[model samples]
Target: MGKGKNKTHEPKNERQQRGANGHSARQNHKHMEMKYDKSEKMKFPVKLAMWDFDHCDPKRCSGKKLERLGLIKSLRVGQKFQGVVVSPNGQGVVCPNDLEIVEQHGASVVECSWARLEEVPFNKIGGKYERLLPYLVAANQVNYGRPWRLNCVEALAACFAIVGKMDWASELLSHFSWGLGFLDLNKELLEIYQRCTDADSVKKAEKEWLEKLEMETQERKSHTKKTDIWMMGNINRRGNGVQSDELESGEDSEQSGLENSEQPIEYDALGNAIHVDSVKSRIMLSGVSEDEESDFEENEKPVNYDSLGNLI
Candidate 1:
């Protein structure tokens, strides 16, 4: 009995040892797999072309060509791209893998994605002046040698205005022109200045547009009034509230009286002349005195007016 018990305990201990070893091995394997996955996700640098499209006519190329040139791509959200990576002295760009890309080609790293470039329409790409204008303005201040920046600044201002970003357009004008002159005195900058000045002109033009809108509104109101009059006439004819025949009869009677007599005759809907034979008799019947009436009229006069002439 003792030998059988010992044999059973020895086998049980071996099984427990095996189970523990298997569990540890599985845990180790999982940890290694997680580390490997993390490393694989990290981006390594690669060499890419930096093309200049500042003067390139986009009209001459297909969409595919634009993509190849890296001109069309914009930055993707949460994606790392390239930039100039400027140092204290403003000179850098050692490893291609070390760099990230940005929208502007001027940056050191390839900063945009093929997706962003392809997503935006070709026509709209050049019209994104608001996005590019501030950089141009800043670059102009840093390096005036680049005459193209001026043109870019102007284009951006105009683009902003066209897109209904008047505040931005105004800001660009105020910053570049320094408040006094429209033209940048730099001869090289003139080309760009001419293009951008239109943004300010656009704001002024909005006033004329508003005046046109007002005129249109007035014309619409007049048309609506005429329609209302016709509707009212029809309503009267249909006897909705009053009869048109009665109104017409009254007008006819007044015209006949005017032709026959020198005195003017005003008739009610029943065609009876509204003749006030005695104004004093009516006032007396109402128990109102002339002096009280005069006092009331004087009190009702507007005090703010210089005189009756001023009221008119």
Candidate 2:
């Protein structure tokens, strides 16, 4: 009897130990999972928000993507916020002077299509300060290489960069593959805008940059024109089987002899024809005589020209 009793107790103890080991393992796994969750949680540096108008494709919309990643918060239409509002009709441009307001109140952007900008109820949008972003190139695939066509994240990033929150800007843009490239594409322009102290300075900087761009474009066009002219001249000379020196000499002789040659018949201001006779050293009327010209009436018909500049 004692041996049998001891055997029964041994089995019970073994079962109990096994149950305890299994529970401990399960608890250890649960703890590990919780620890991982904490580590993986993303912490945004600033309180970034936006008002999405659902005007873009869900898959392609940067604002929605950021919201899914918990990087940005979305507000309803006409919702009130004390942050700096990025609007197309902003009162002024975002600059370093607004850094304090941005840091204190955070920043928010209006997410809508550039086409439907007029449909947006700007008056209902609430914000302590409404500001426009300075000129910045888009890095998103859709509007890549286009200026002032930034998506929500890009606009926010630009504001952050202008306010001296470069790390924040970088972090905001880091989510997208082409995001960081935006800063690189507009590196010089951004740097110039970032250095400005206020809206006035930013405006001045933008003006200067625009002027420089315009000048460069004009220079490029002039260079292209000169190149085209030279190529045409060269082709003409080659086609005529003439050397450059010979062509120049021929042109000079032709110009000098032109004064002595009989000139072609031409029209005067009154539509009367005048014939030039170099030998007689006098002008003669041909198409209409002076008395007949006075009696002529002006034609009221519309004149048309063909593509080749011939009267049609």
Candidate 3:
């Protein structure tokens, strides 16, 4: 017997072929036809929102769908939690996609048109922990192939991916026509980015990925993004917590009754908009009511929860 090797030798070409096949298989995994689990229903931990500045089509918007599914529960601006505000304008590269970040701070996404970002009512809502999601391509009907034009749920799903929670993200997006396509586009980069902890690290990974995917990206004037110019806490002419085209069509104008008055919107330290007049039964300080006890009683005991905002 030959003073032998412990195992039979594979031909070099065969070994290389096997390695290539394995890699190809893995790459293909990201592109596999996305399957939806019909029975899969989940309540993701992060709070999602859309400022609804553009007055997104009620019929087609993914955020509205998420809200209907109860996956995106509405929380009043005054209600308390450590939250991350996703802004395309944020100078900080850090985002809420990391597990520690999500566990420590809940995530929120604002939906505004990338083209006319000036229209979003930034001053209406309060935000402290600002975050900027790195460049990612759009996969929706209106702005397909465009980067940074994500719908609300898709943006939140990316945050979910950053925190390494893919299942919940996928489930929310499964209802959209191009939902799976987003995950496919960002899987590898997200896997890389989620490992980063801070803003600088996240930005580093983002820069690398952007360079790699440089060809697929489209460039527009930086002016299109008003992330730097807008100031928070400066309520616009609308004066309420929102300003949209819907409002211009005389929706909230009558209810606000402030078309002539020039008083600035008053906000508490926590950023709650304080109306001079008692809010009507239809409008509430808390979430919209489907029940009769519509008044938001300040004396109602707050739910006792741990520091993590988890029920004790």
- Best TM-score among the predictions, by candidate number: 2
User: Which residue pairs show collisions in model 2?
Assistant: none
Provide the clashing-pair count of each candidate structure: 13, 0, 3
Cα lDDT tens digits for candidate 2, 176-280: 999999989988988898899999999899989889989999988765644433322222311224444543444532222322456653333432223344312
Best by lDDT: 2
Better of 2 and 3 by lDDT: 2
Question: Candidate 1, which segments miss by more than 4 Å at Cα?
Answer: 1-72, 77-196, 233-312
Question: What are the per-residue Cα lDDT tens digits for candidate 1 across 1-312?
Answer: 111111122355543232211333345235324433432332111111222221223332221132233322222122222433211112221122211222232221122222234432233112111122211222333334443233323333333333334454354445443311323333232233333334344333444545775899998976564443332213332212434444444443322333366533233222223222443432332234657535755787412211111321
Better of 1 and 3 by lDDT: 3
Model 3 has an lDDT value of: 0.52
Error of 1 at 86 (Å): 27
Q: Per-model C-alpha lDDT, please?
A: 0.31, 0.65, 0.52
Q: Lowest-lDDT window of 10 residues in candidate 2? A: 1-10
Residue 96 alpha-carbon offset, candidate 2, angstroms: 0.3
Give stretches of model 3 more than 4 Å off: 1-42, 75-81, 94-98, 215-312
Each prediction's TM-score versus the true structure? 0.21, 0.64, 0.50
Query: Is 1 or 3 the stronger prediction by TM-score?
Result: 3
